[model samples]
Target: MADVMDIVIVASAFGMDAVRAQGHLKCAQASRRAGAAGFEVRRELFAGEAEAAPQRLRALGCAIAELGLWSVFSTPAALYTADGRLDAAALRLAFDEASALGARFVKLQLGGFVRDAAGAEIAEQTQDSNVRLVVENGQLAEGGSLTQFVGLFDALAREEHAHVLGMTFDIGNWAWRDVAPLEAAAQLAPHVEYIHCKTTMGEGARRFSAAPAADDTRFIAVLDRLPRDVPRGIEFPLDATRVEADAAHYVEWLAAV
Candidate 1:
């Protein structure tokens, strides 16, 4: 285990296709904004043929914490996409790229697959990788039911690749779905390699908000439950146009925590 207070920022929202395609310049310029400390290069870059993507990212002068290698597609619990069906070639290439740069770790999304009786959904881990992989559950369906995910994780823990693979638990997402954050954290603790902290609220309608891990009132308990040693990722959403303000917000929020 590692210190949870060693929080880092991972840039994904700003660099997702739409933002990067049209807002890249502004995005790049905004990195200097106050709250945007520890900017992270997204894993999408690995989707292309630049086998040296990680090296290129590091060369760009950004503070590299970890690079997202792959994200499984899911919206809550429904399997919108088949697991291991997305551009495997691209993911493999990306993994290679990240490993080549000697990145500390890679982030993976745990979604996209409808669990089968034999548990074939997690087949992707068998792919090449010497880098640490952090798998996160983003599309928790029915508001945080852990059944399917637990099955997946159990399989992952026994897989040959388990040595380098661990979990990325998002406290806010679980809370939004109405799960008690501490319980979820306890269930996820053993497998967690890193933490992605965010705060969310709402009932029939849902909203995702970014707050300091400590000030996220509902999730503070979850934070307390986390092992002091796990790596933390403070992934906050920012309004692209209001980059500076949002950046400052994150800085202040973190300072408060």
Candidate 2:
């Protein structure tokens, strides 16, 4: 079994966009102070700081767990030209960023079919690179649903790319899409290599809250179904004034898991 204490603190939880607007150095420093095993790096959070960000994070003893990119491969406008084809150039850039960050995996949202030519191309391209690719369930329609993920993985299996591809399951995202977390967990556990731990409250306009919220028992069920070896991390909003304390609480909560 894996030690839950190894839970990472995702940078975005701490107002990452705002931090990026200012800088990434502070975010890295703060993560270290909070005693996180590592931090998930979103491309937006390192806009102008990518060159120096890795070194700074390393200096503070923070590892780069994953590199997040926001490309919708299904949409020609997003990753391809008007002719409607995979934009190898854009895809390479995403891989390049993941490589530069030294992340174990490049995490992306599953916005389309894995059986698509572009998706197959992604698997082939990634096989030659050090950084692995993982698709996550995003909280919007564009992101894809649990059913879509199952189909994607099944297709990857048929193409023999399932061994190379994996998943990053977001606990709260199931709620966002109106899917029961535990049900999704049972179906996606086999491919999950990373996890996003957070709880959501309300219905139409849901909001993020720390894990283990009184009304949210989904985490308990989902956690039980997850592979113990995977990296499970907190991805909820953090109180800036109590960053360290908030982070510590999350770690402690995971420890008790």
Candidate 3:
């Protein structure tokens, strides 16, 4: 049998719909008990828990797989202030925080990159960082299309920063932009360092749900297209009433895949 991949439980899943309270320490403890190999610390879920997040996760024996930040790096209007300059200070702080948290990867959105000053700054700063920088195929506005992501990654590769920069392939995010998951996976798999595994239910404005069983052909097909060595994280809604059981089931299901 092949070795099981590392399964990480993203904190945001548990806190969905405000069902579970937001507490990084509590989330870490639950994740460790639920058989998750690691925990992803989301910036939105951190709230005021940022300062001591690393220490808290350490005490709970939960490995920090990635630090997820929500920042738009495309246009100066989104990343800069009134003075029309790149917010290098803010960007540095985000990277610094990820480093302090002991996370191996810092995940962000690929804002805008062709001749964009912010993108240039990101490549320059990431070259010197200890943590790997991963840009994800977020919802439409961030980076939802295969063409968009490929262009960005190809651009970075030419700059020689691809070694330090990687891709976080979100399996279900393709649906949000009408892109086929398999096609996106095929194009981005080589550059992937992390995977966000989630499936959606319903047609319009679908609800994010856990991965199907390993035997499910759709699930297996997508898994086969991704890099097995990369850490795959569960980024879905959790049943607050049965959070532990739900998490454990997800881990087992993904392991089988």
Which predicted model would earn the best lDDT? 3
TM-score of each: 0.64, 0.79, 0.79
Worst 10-residue stretch by lDDT in candidate 1? 68-77
lDDT per model, in order? 0.51, 0.64, 0.65
Error of 3 at 200 (Å): 0.7
RMSD, model 1, all Cα superposed? 6.2
Q: Which stretches of candidate 2 lie over 4 Å from their true place?
A: 1-5, 47-88, 114-120, 206-210, 214-216
C-alpha-based local distance difference test score of model 3: 0.65
Q: Return whichever of 2 and 3 wins on lDDT.
A: 3
Evaluated at residue 93, the lDDT of candidate 2 is 67
lDDT of 2 by residue, 60-109 (tens): 22332332211111111123333435556666666666665566666766
List, residue by residue over 39-138, the lDDT tens digit for candidate 3.
Answer: 7766655444543355653432233333232111111112333343445675665576666665667776655443323456776887777777776876
- Model 3 TM: 0.79
Clashing pairs in 1: 2-229, 2-230, 3-229, 35-247, 76-139, 77-141
TM-score of 2: 0.79
The candidate with the higher lDDT, 1 or 3, is: 3
Stretches of model 1 off by over 4 angstroms after superposition? 1-4, 13-38, 44-58, 61-91, 100-102, 112-130, 140-145, 157-162, 175-178, 203-206, 212-215, 239-256
Clash statistics: count for each candidate: 6, 0, 1
